[model samples]
Target chain A: MRLRIIKAYFLKEMIELIRTKMIMMPYLMPLLIVILFGYGIKMQVTGVRTLILDNDNSQISRKMILKFEHSKYFTTTVKNMSEKDALREIKKANIDAIIIIPSSFEKNSLKGIKTEIGVFIDASFPSRSTTISNYIQGVVMDLANDFNINSSGMININTRNLFNQALRDEEMIVPGLIGMVLLISPAILTALIIAKEKEEGTIFNFYSSPVSKGEFLVAKLSAIFFLVSIAIFVIFLVASYLFDLPFRGSFFLFWLASEFYVFTALGFGLLVSIIASSQIVAIIVTLMLTIIPAFMYSGMIMPISSMSGDAFITAHIYPVMYYNHIIYDTFLIGQGFNSPTNISYLLLLFGYGIVLFLLGLLFLKKEIK
Target chain B: MKIFITILLKELISFFRSFGLVILVIYFFTAEVYVAANGMEIEAKNVAVGVVDKSAGGMSKKILSNLHSPEFQTPKFYKSQKELSDAIYNKNIMVGMIFDEQFEKDYYKKLNPTINILIDSTTASQSLMAIGYIQNILMKFNNLELPVALKMHKLFNQNADTGLFMGVSELLSVITLLTTILTAIAFVKEKESGTWDIMLLMPVNPKIIILAKSLSQIIIIMIGVVLSVGLILFQSLDVPINGNLLHFFILTFFYVATTAGIGLFIAAVSKNIMQISQLSIVIMMPIIFLSGAWTPIYAMHPLLQYLSALSPLSYYIEGCESIFFRGTSFVDLLPYFGGVLILGVILYWYGFRKIGKLF
Candidate 1:
């Protein structure tokens, strides 16, 4: 844990990571990030296939029809048809829902009486259908308000959601992939660098030659981190220019954040690599720790908040959670990045990176012994 | 039988010695339990519901009241359409509603009255239920007098039980797959560790070693299986395990044998654990992804669906649902048994051949 020991270890770890293909990942990440973010979002909110059965064919009903068909929410298979026909269409999945305007609608309106428009929604995908329902209701009521249905009551709200726009699947996955790719690449490199030495009986060279662990690790991580940063920069440039994803924040901040993230991942990966006698244990242990957590709890398909207390608590223990928070926050949030927490997370990431880097160095001594 | 038993015992003894193997099991099962209980879910409880009432009339009050009712308590007091839209786009709210100014007039008039609901469809599902609940209340309030019937149609059945749906499929996949893969690796990793030859050097025949390993793990596996079942049950997941408990053991035994065959096959062929582990992952990922554990396999494209059908998990789940959810007899589950046994035999035969080549 001495300063020299730490620095020497950092150098060694970095050299090991660099010698392995871990150094190439940072550059590869942005391309992977873009592909993962740009292409993965299946946001098909259209072609919702709506059929309208206009019973009234009246002015008000026609207005309702106009609102639905033109508002971009409904791709119409609408017909002035029988209830039986509508039912058949519904069964065929030809329409998400049917809007029924009764025969008495216009008549009732003329008499200053109650008239109703019916809407059926397919709420199987509660997320999408609910939004669709609300959108339908809003368009109808806007026109109705113009018609002076002064008593329309708080109008029925319907909304339909097509696809997610807040964050794409690629965006969610790319950041996690950053952690995942680095996990294997750097850790394997770090382990093999050391393990290779051990396996071939070269540790005596390092010990006998006065090549301190601290210097070795620092040089190793720094080289890998620098190479990774270059990789990330290229990916970001391509992602922004080619993929049309908005790079809303400072490139420097992303670098700072990922550097911290990479360091921590690389550190733990290195530490586990050192604990291992062979390259095999190192790879399995690192992957087992990194891959599953990266996939499951990173707010991709499942929300971390929804995870039960224990799993939720456990998810935080992995560096993946922090990395995910930062990646999403920086990439998607687009909010000004001058906050104390953001700054702190960045620092904590770096701090852990350094600490774990040291831990790997310290642990390497024991493994070697 | 004795040879198989010998192989199994040798594998089990090797497993306890491998720190990585034991830890992986603990991590996998424990995490699965935690994920089933907490991580794997659809959450919408605190989702903001934005409402805009242009009417400012009597019905607005009623709609607001209804939204605020104790039985249907949801926060529904959003101000403007812009605000609501912004909230939704920003992922702040799950749903939004806009009642036109004439809402009061339409309800007061005996005319076709309508209300617009602008809903944030993200972070929520089966939203028509919420919309329908409101419409039903209004319909009841009006004594079913509205000319249009508020029919609620569900798009996809998100209402399908997550625990039952996920647990039953996953139980089959992870348990069968993990056990088989581990059993396969058991003897081989020890051989790599140089422990197998040491055991072979002792009084024990290779056959007895297999038996001891299989028998040794029987208790631990049963314990692991029970613990997993307990973890799931503890969360009140409420997935039915209606088949005979004894039948579970019987099915598991055959399934395990088949998986063990697969494991042995992997171990016998591979020079090292990494090779087999990588192979296991490659084999397992598609099976897990396609077998409808996390996402519906039927939901996948046709090609992927066919691939899913190829996985043993499809049979396992089909048989499991029959036994667990539908409560069918073991005879009814013969297809699953047959599939497992066939797969096992093929893998074991290949494994034995590979082992013969290596030794």
Candidate 2:
């Protein structure tokens, strides 16, 4: 438990980290993920390419095709290919959907009869196909209402989108990316430290020395935690500036919360490394334990509330879930820091950190014996 | 040929002796199967919304009543807009809606009265779909008369099984990642332990050694693929692979072969296991992103769509999806097979050349 020994170990780790460029590698990950997910990974489904085949070729059918063309969701074109060719292209995934207006479409609609419009969707990707189908339905309904306007009752519903008016995927994606990247980088950075030492036959130095396991673990954790926190702070600034992210919460509270989250993640990493016999096992285990859960159970992309039984239970146990919730709250919701629920979740996150570090200390002692 | 067989046997023995590698292989399969079965769903269902109705009129009531389950939970009534906003801020509800005082009056007068929706945009995709639901409910409430009926025919996946799509795509991605990583690790592990130089000193050709190593890795990866596809995806998850089974495996072989070449190239470049792991992420990220496994290529910018051609995964995902969903025959899948084959040959040549220099 010597302070001098711990500080020396901390400095040694810092020098190694700098020499290996490990510290610099993590910094790149957050930025790459932010830009890639922000610009490249578009969740909003738009510009779905659709082919419209018209058997009727009537003025009414042309009007229907025009409605689809005008939609923001669909980029529609009237392809004059035969049904077989259209099906081939659809199977080849050249087209997302095909709309066929029946031969008696105009006559039936003019006679005030219900006309069945055929919409064939390539449903390989379910969500996209569902969106395309929904868009088609909306357009068809709009056309139907237009035809029966004199006898129908239609109310224009003006919908107002609050907070994120544009609903930029970046706004939401950036914050979640911050949560995921911060957790994973710190955990992995700390995870390989002890395992690397053992693999290189350097652990015998510590075993022969007077530095206690607690002190050794603390020294390593603090160094990696410090590097990771600084990296996260820099990433936060870059994300805020680069993506124009709104920072409405108190900066101090956000920073404090981030520290606790990083400690918890690093502690988990230390725990994994302490038990792992080899660097490969440590890395693969850390990756599987942290990255998958961080992506899936942390509610980064999918809301925890929406998860079913097995996944929902898993989410509640992981510390990443609480951290992800805190990030979303502090970044987007901007509720005051003193809120009881917010405090409770943050406490739970700190609790996980303390428990994990203590567990790692206990295991290291047993391994020494 | 005797030297190749000897090298291949040694590689296989080392791989089998490592219990950690076996566990990791098992972990990858089971975890993917679990996530694909349970996760990969983004559809908003039973979303609880807070409502503030100032109008208290027939139209407002009708809209509220129309909100039903599988999409919306029973709406909780709020005393005022402040309460609704607080609930949303606290995450007690995903969304908050406020109906204006002139709701029914404006509707009858053909003056559009706005319904304000405050969404927690952190759940981005769900919020977007929630908007769709609100719009659809409004459309239903508005157009009570007969409209032109739309008959939707979902050609491939009729029920729109998201799990099936996610499971199958994940299977391919996992196979690609595992084969590449394990092969790279195997190559570097020997170098790190000082056995690579010994092997290099042998009279065996470097090409033979490389092929032997890749062959061992390919065999193991193929077994994992079969177990994942057969036990997990097809049987456990009930994902129907509609294509010819033989054609799919042939395509998978080419895909895995291309990755092995890429892995060998990485091994030649890296100095240690740590470096290999780091480089793996660097190499794998771009492939996964551009592969259209998670996001559709049609959704990407045209430039990205073109750039995706450089990644063999892009062809693999498309070809696999076509085979699984559309049941397209082998000859029709010539383009995908050729893409993987060409990339494999090029990378294999480059990697072998680099290894020759390393020795």
Candidate 3:
């Protein structure tokens, strides 16, 4: 664990990485992920292509149809088609939903008789369908209010979205995407680099030399960690400027937590490299471990609190969830070290880093098996 | 023909020889699908909510009581707005409610009472769904009886269970990823291990060799898909197959072939396994994003929506969902088939030519 040995190994690792042209991966991967997901993945389903069959053709039905057209959630086209044709359009996967206003709608509404407007939705994806259904109901409710049909109570709920004022999907997605990119790139880069040494028999140099295991592992981890940190910093700057993401919390605190997270990722990569027999196996194993959990359990798309049973436990096990919490709190909630919960998550991330690195050192054999 | 058979057999035997890869494939097809399907919940469930009801023992209590389990946790009673806001900031609660002292009086006097809802919208999907649920609950307290009622018929999936959808979607994504990686690695492995010259020196046609290698990996992937569909989708998750099973498999074969074409291109460019993985993610992420597996195509921007037509995956996902959920007929499935085939031929030809030049 001498300083000279560590520095020499670190420089060697850096030069080798640059020589192989693998250094570009950390920078390129985050840029690609940010561009792809930031612009591409949207939770808010808008511009729902809809077809309307106004069988009534009355002024009241026309006004009702106009409400659907005005709502941002739905883009409706009033066509002179039967219900059968509208449904056929839905089956072709051409349209998202169909609104059928019956032939006798105006007559019944004027007489205070309850009129039923049929809303057939394509519920293949339940979450999207539910949002569409809610939107339709909201439009219908507005129409009811317009008609002065006072059917329900007078309670008005004013929802104030707290953290993200506009409720922009990018505000939530970008922070989580940062966590995901950090996890995947560092882990994969370290794992593959180390596994490449093993595959090419370059690892025997370390085994045959006077370098200790702790010093060897630390030098490799730190060198890759330095590269990953710069890449993530560039990503942070680009994402903040591009998405107009507000940094509500302390930059130093966020930087510190991110470093811990990067260490955890690199250590996991080290563990994978130790166990993998070849470069191909190492890459696949790293992907299988990182990509799935990052998407599923990290609370990026799904909320951990709402998850039940094994999923909840699994989310707790991954360090990505902890980092996700820190990113959301600092970026969205604008909270820093003041909150006890935030501190605990930061500490947990630190603990994950130490544990993973220790595990890597424990597994790294001085001699070939 | 004899040469193609021999090469195909050689590829299959070598694939089986790699014990780690075999186990990786099996785990991906089985355990991976099961965990993702059972765990991922898109709909709101057990949302943590906090409440400060100043107008106690009146309609406020009744409204507060309506927030129950499954949709929400029993609302934690906080002392004031300050405490509740702190709870939200601490990430202790997702949604907070404040009912002022005038709530009950305002309701009785027909003076539209407003209940302030403080929501942490960082988790967009959950918060949005929770808002819808709260609105539905509050509708019970509304007095006006509208003359017109809207009846919603949720077609295909009646209950709107996300498990069924996620399970199948996960399976489809897994199929895409594995097909591309396996095919790319098959060729890249030869180059990495210094066997490329020997492979080129063989008397067999390069086309036959390429066809045989890719076909072997595709067969392996088909087996993985069958295992996933049987063990995870059908047996555990109960994803209903509404249309003919043969139609789904045929569609899957076309998709696998198209993706393998992309893999061929990746192998032609990369010198080793590291580049294969990196390049795979670079190429695959955009395809997956455009495919509407994670996000629906209709939800994308107009420019991206048009671009999705170039991605073969978009058609595959739509075609599969139609067969499984919409029960679309084979004749009606022609457009999807056409989309995949047209794209597959172009991509396959390009990749085939790129690698064939090396031989």
Instruction: Give me the candidate number with maximum DockQ.
Output: 3
Candidate 2: chain B TM-score against the reference chain B: 0.91
How well docked is model 3, in DockQ terms? 0.72
Query: Between the candidate structures 1 and 2, which one is better when assessed by DockQ?
Result: 2
lDDT of 1: 0.58
Candidate 2 regions off by >4 Å?
Answer: A145-158, A366-369, B53-69, B98-116, B138-140
How accurately is candidate 1 docked according to DockQ? 0.16
Q: Can you write out model 3's per-residue Cα lDDT over B1-359, one digit (the tens) per residue? A: 88888999999999999887799889889988887777777788899899998884578888878988889988888998999999888777889999999888888887888899999898887898899999999887785667778888998898888888888888888898989899999999999888999999988889999999999999999999988888789998888887888999999999899999999999999988778887898899989988887677877778988999999999999999998888888878899999999999999888899888889
Worst 10 residues of 2 chain B by lDDT: B139-148
TM-scores for every predicted model: 0.64, 0.94, 0.97
lDDT for each residue of candidate 2 in A120-155, tens digit (9 for 90 to 100) = 999998887777777887788678667656533455
* lDDT (Cα, tens digit) per residue for candidate 3, span A239-282: 79998898898788789889999999998899999898788788
lDDT values of the candidates? 0.58, 0.81, 0.87
Model 2: residue A217 alpha-carbon error in angstroms: 2.1
Each model's Cα RMSD = 8.7, 2.6, 1.7
Better of 2 and 3 by lDDT: 3
Error of 3 at B353 (Å): 1.4
Q: Pick by lDDT: which candidate is best?
A: 3
- DockQ for every model comes to 0.16, 0.54, 0.72
Clash count of each predicted structure:
111, 0, 12
